[model samples]
Target chain A: MLRTYVDMNLVSGKQPHAWDLGEFYLIDRIRALVPDIDLTDDCAQIELPYEGTLLFTTDAAIRGVHFPEDSKYIADGGFRALAGAVSDINASAGKPLAALLALVIPPELTLSEFDRFLSGLLEYSRHSEVPLVGGNISRGDRFGATISVIGSSNKVVTRSGARPDDLVVLSGSIGGSEIGRMIISGEASDADIKSLDSEIIGTLLYRHLRPLPPLGLGEKLAAIGATSMVDISDGLIADVEHIAEASGVNIHIELGKLPLYPGVTEIAQRHRIEPAILAAESGEEFELIATMSLKDAEELEKLQMPMTVIGRVRSGNGFVDVTLNGEPIPPGFSEGWKHF
Target chain B: MLRTYVDMNLVSGKQPHAWDLGEFYLIDRIRALVPDIDLTDDCAQIELPYEGTLLFTTDAAIRGVHFPEDSKYIADGGFRALAGAVSDINASAGKPLAALLALVIPPELTLSEFDRFLSGLLEYSRHSEVPLVGGNISRGDRFGATISVIGSSNKVVTRSGARPDDLVVLSGSIGGSEIGRMIISGEASDADIKSLDSEIIGTLLYRHLRPLPPLGLGEKLAAIGATSMVDISDGLIADVEHIAEASGVNIHIELGKLPLYPGVTEIAQRHRIEPAILAAESGEEFELIATMSLKDAEELEKLQMPMTVIGRVRSGNGFVDVTLNGEPIPPGFSEGWKHF
Candidate 1:
């Protein structure tokens, strides 16, 4: 069972120093292994009772800066740190209701690799049903987590409510996490995923070990009225220039309605680069750009919604543009993911 | 003005690398230096127009495991990581409202030590009026933060609501953070605080560089009904054995009603030890403790409060006891605070 509790909490050749198992015996072995985690005290009341607005967020991750500490998909770095903090509670449309994490961990990490990073953070907190209430763990030198999450709603979609002609859209396909981080930093080998086409190496290792965050298409574009939204985790022209500088407005885009991901132009022509600059600068791509109007983009195109439109908004000053068939695509090459 | 923005964000000897200042230019320089931080997107909605329950928590801290990075009181490690996450939102009496942080840091630290750790986390988020909203930052190796907070309420006390005879109390004094961590780990010197007594070196450097959490006496002992609480942070017999194992009962204590800290028995007899085992194991001593009802502890001692009672609860199986004048005080020495 659970591999004999990960071989009786291995860390064998004399490791033991998370204060030698003390923080209340590791919070009583995480309350006897997360027995439906109430965490019995020091905060986590939760209740919300009804009404709305909570959302929150946070994120982090770290290890060799966001994953790959000698890869073999290090439990997809705890499932991309709770899928990048529930992709910012699904780009603010909100729903997931709890999480906290913090972590740190690295006194030579082993209790079976921290129980496979808490089984990839309890398998994405049980596929986002959320609830791992409170957190904090410490010891450092590397490995990280942070997480946070929260969520709740009653129409919370922000990025400063886009306006001028609104449209944008997106929800899927972007450079498959820069070709699954060049095949987890081995600089793209496995004979370029056995010369590709195994459904493009299972869509670039499921967009880099499990990303899929359109959280029910951002709550169906915040109930078909999304005015602004973001979550492309740094790309698609730096998240449509953060919804055009938080809605001071401009955008444009339309580089032939770029959806791109099917093997990102054969892995950006085997790394020579430009598949429209890895579809507008490769980054995590949790995918859900948004903005709405033309009557909620004609009622999300009468609900067919896998999504794409790719740009519009107006009234200037906030920049972004691009084009292509209509001509003007010149911006000194790709760039995006820089997370200081 | 803010020392010329900390000498123009100095990390001078060409230190750069927080991905060369880009997570959208450090979130547009933390939205132009925390302009009342609403952080325009990717979660942080907040609102909560009424009802109750929230609370939450989190904590972390790290850097050399909670403080002392060449201590010039390292900006009270960002004010004890937001007063240890608002002392678990004032031991759950709740009220604080918001916070988030996460942080991490360490690319050769300076920017005037990250703006004096954001001016000790905006001076304890403006003395707990809370607000910092959302957070994250990243880059790792050393510095840390985590924080979290939240809070709210309408009666949410918990530690599993003590019962039997209740009483217990506490609120103030305990070992002054193990003599301000043996005078910040130089193993206690300044002639041991000039042979002590300048109000015991200002109550051991204000219980180790600013602790102060009894958030309004844990909201007046949770509006005078507190059936259980806990803050002491790994001390007073490991936080009254976590409210007697979350109220399955037992407690007792009474070893001469400990309220230590005023020089903790002359620094536990100048470190030879036993001043009632540094008043029952030294740890952080954030205070609080709780459990109540002897008619709300005689209406909180006719509303004077600073508190003490120091023991009671009952039933059993959860352990703790101690005594002294009534005899039985043998528990194989003091113990507590060994965080790892």
Candidate 2:
């Protein structure tokens, strides 16, 4: 009998209205879902046995801007939101301890949709071993969530530690998420998504929906003597520019050595756009870009980490220079992503 | 000069567009405003000195719900948002160290409005000595802020430790914020607000605009052997019910003993409503509600901590009972504030 109500409320789309259920009922439901959460208190308490530094980061995903409201990817939206927040912890070389989620929901959204979102969030939390310790829900005109991740680290990495003679490393490939977003946002037709090989479609959709940041790899990089690091949240050039400005050094990228996804060139050609533009300008990649010494980079390479050195730091005013085919590239090659 | 550009951009309302200035440009402005914040990293790191527990809490303030979009109370909304978040730390007998803010802004909001909101947030951070370590800004239909407070304590107090014979104490008065909201939301007329005395208006507005939570009081209560504690963000009855349910004890409140705001009676009379209902149903009180032994309660009273004993815990199934003039109160007396 209880299972019937649960299924009706969470799967059949025949659930009581949120206004009728009230806030406490929703909180009770969440508590039942995440039983480890301490919902009886005003604040969640976490004990730290050893002395360490606490790392904090917050990220938000809006309905229209970050995800489509009308699409069937609501669960994917939740996964992406939490993953984006956890990616910051990964970038900092810290072990995530817990997370706090604040969700703003529109009245038009149904309980089943909310349940799917929570399922996605819980799935990530269970996989990452970071419990959802605290949260708040409020009414809003559109659905959105702000996820704050709390982490701890013995040795913290910052974006201002790179030196002049460091090699810049790119973790894995970029531009895949942008391609996936385009497909999900209907910029690409259903036939376009279907005509693509299943592996490519699956890979692109997975990358776009649940872009997993390689956790623990950041700590390994830190141990291997990475000087500075940043996540590719706002595209390669833009994010690297942050490291350059913060470290007060110039970065020269060997464009010919840039890493690209397998089908990026074909997709860009089909879309009548340059592959370099997609590689440089696509955002939400969630890949780490770090700077290290040549010896450290060689050691990391030997360890078989999925990263490639694509640039070198120089002593100059903070600016990024690009070279292609052993020649200085002209200005306006790839402006990178701009968010406002 | 930079000052001219700032004034023109912020005050003259003829500023460069947000899209033109870009997200990074706004972040730079915020960094300049709060110079102590470390903005050059993906995560801000805080060192934990010794063995202790970390307290985490998050709260959100939506534009239409928490404050009117057309009203000039945007700054007050910001102040209330941070204060409400900090109140959770106070409830747990914790000292806040830092906060992370995530703001969603509409495109129509001016640069000056955003500046004022930040000013309000910074003012609270400065006064509380809790730094704004990190935050994220994104676009949305209406302005809203989610504030996550990180705190620490040697001994934490929760809401589940009250004994059967414990006494319930309230730190301060209630119902002023609700009255102020009525006025601000235009449910009450300008004449209704004006007919009230200046002192009453000032007190109500102050309580409404910037609800102050007694932070050190919770710690002091914990040190003096408080069994359980909670902050009255919801309402007196609603919040006390939380302690009762968590502690697995019944709470009986003496209606005549409630600490009501000075103008509560007058405002209730003017509105043709019962003062008890106002005291019981108002939200955002931000006052500490604690449970302790009679001896500790007496000691606290002797210290003149602006608290009064309103109820006592009894061994029973978790429930709240109300009494008036030594008579048992009936059901549906005070339904309390409902958030939906």
Candidate 3:
């Protein structure tokens, strides 16, 4: 049932702990699904190839399957659980570079509680300069963290580059990491948090415990052309049906042009849950869902962090409709979060 | 009680699972400790300042701490517990290259019993082309195996370059891996099977389950002119008291010029133990202990895997002595295998 992409304009960026807005809309949807790498910054320029291109990816976070045991700072929850496996190689725009990490703990841990979970993953990799390079400390019988990153993308954003009428966009906002996991799972009630909106529930519990993606906007949406991309860590109708089954095409959306944030429709009417199924199955909400050309979304709405269109693409293959007023609404019954 | 270096030597020439042994004897043992850069074999000739070099080391093996928990490829017990942490960058003659693997397992395992422990570590890293690259699967809540390797050294072998009267050498043989973990723990019996010498009990159970070090022979003893270097991975009197406390001095040795092997004194007289404390603390011996200049061990004993001498150096400070018959002896009760 994977379908996310609840779209609040895919994280609006302005640097929360380091530029948020759902990590600049999943680096503008992995710079339009990697247009020959260079995810934009913080060192990444590989050349070696006798057997190069082996940058694999794997990220598991379980324990209530993704945070909240006593929540927050188990070393930025092991630096956002190894920054969601180096944000799937920075959402394929690539270059989050080197990682293996593999932790598991839980057997009533201690070695100084795994050194405060490696002091919050070495101060979130020394404030994200990212260099714990390789890892694997164990005990596990389950507490989970699993990482795998190995970046180096001189150019490679793949999800099958979108086409047809294109223009889907996003990059931020969706359901405040599903109303910050319903206020860390009490299922929100302090009188439904006095009819909420506290600066959009403190930016949806700071996008569910510090998300901040959009680093170097995936080489500026593959240097301004972007046709297709992914990374909405399952939401927005399960990451646009994985960009409609990796670009074969057909997407649609428009549930009254979705972009909600003010108390996610009264916390989806006090937990009956359907503010687009807590923004379509709430995953980590990394954001980014590209597919350009509405004249490059009017020149990416004159950059400075654009992308917000929300839906189009055609010629059929996957989720061919979502509508709302015109009918079809069977599109918001939880469409993400799966592990096993 | 930490001492182990399961009697050294793996010998064999240049690259075929690569092995050079030189960085001129690890820049005569760590060029006065740290910073010199550019070391090559070409392939972007070195120069990696900080975006890399996180390399770490951890080794552990215990059943009797380093082997024999039942054999016949009990998955070369996780490929000699990751070739004893890639024999500490092949005892600083360097090259281990990459690794992150962290297995703890033991809940009486099964998943086809750890797929023959990843098929004896992907057949010894596909016969040593080095590449387990990423890892961290867990369960261990401990039968034995700790491995932690993370290599890349063109010039990093440190034990403090032995000066004084130099020439200590060794790179091979020493109470054959405690006579192959006493014939895989039956403490030697197989009753006179084949009236003794089965080619020195099959080269002491193939150097106690493949201890093989020699890889990139520390960049060919740091491109010749060897000086200092370690890698006997504990023992040889605690790795010559860690190169006589990092080359402050003393050393000596002799004990009828060590070496031993061929049915190591009939497997230390059927396991009564002492063959010099099972050649000083028997552990998975990867070998190495360098230090040269007797005109670079008579010009690296005219090439093709040479080295041997067996001891010297003087000026004193870290005391290591040894001799036998011609005198000394004392420094007995050796110590090596110490975790915690």
TM-score of each: 0.37, 0.94, 0.32
Q: Give lDDT tens digits, candidate 3, residues A1-340.
A: 0013323222443212211223234334333433332222111222233232334454555444466556333544666676666665655565554554545444444333344555565555555555554343333334555554555444445566788897788775677777777776767866786767577677777677667667656546755777666667757777777777667788887756667655777878876866755675567777666777777566665567845776788987766477654667675455476422
Q: Model 2, A1-340: lDDT tens per residue? A: 4445556776756665553455676788789899988878989899864756889989898877786676477888888888889999889988999999888877777676787888888888888888899788888888889999999887788888889989999888888887777777677667555656879877887887888888777787898999999888888888888888998999988767777876677677678876766777788888899999988888886557688888999987678887775788765566665332
| Residue A129 accuracy (lDDT) in model 3 | 57
lDDT of 1 by residue, B1-340 (tens): 4434334556344434442453445655666767777666777877774876887888787766777667366678888788877887788888787887878777666544666776777887788678787676867768777888787878878787888988888877778887777776767777756767687777687677678787767777888898889787767887788778878888888767787777767766876876766778877678888888788888787557578887888898578888765677777466776542
Candidate scoring better on DockQ of 2 and 3: 2
By DockQ, highest first, what's the ranking? 2, 1, 3
The CA lDDT of each predicted structure is 0.75, 0.82, 0.57
Residue A37, candidate 2: how far off, in angstroms? Answer: 1.3
Error of 3 at A7 (Å): 51
Q: Each prediction's DockQ?
A: 0.33, 0.83, 0.02
Better of 1 and 3 by TM-score: 1
Positional deviation of A238 in candidate 3, in angstroms? 23
DockQ of 1: 0.33
Q: Where does candidate 1 chain A have its weakest 10-residue lDDT segment?
A: A11-20
Worst 10 residues of 3 chain A by lDDT: A14-23
Runs in model 3 lying further than 4 Å from the true structure: A1-66, A70-83, A86-88, A95-99, A102-135, A138-148, A151-173, A176-180, A187-264, A268-283, A289-340, B1-216, B219-336
Candidate 2 chain B: 10-residue stretch with minimal lDDT: B15-24
Sort by lDDT, best first: what order?
A: 2, 1, 3
Predicted candidate 1 versus true structure: per-residue lDDT over A1-340, tens digit per residue: 4434334556344534443454455555666666677666888877774867788888788767877776355677888888888888888888878887777777676554665776777787788678687676767777777878787877778887888898888866688877877776777787766767787777687687677686666777888899888888777887788778777888888767777887777767877876766777777778888888877787876667578787788987678888766888776454686432
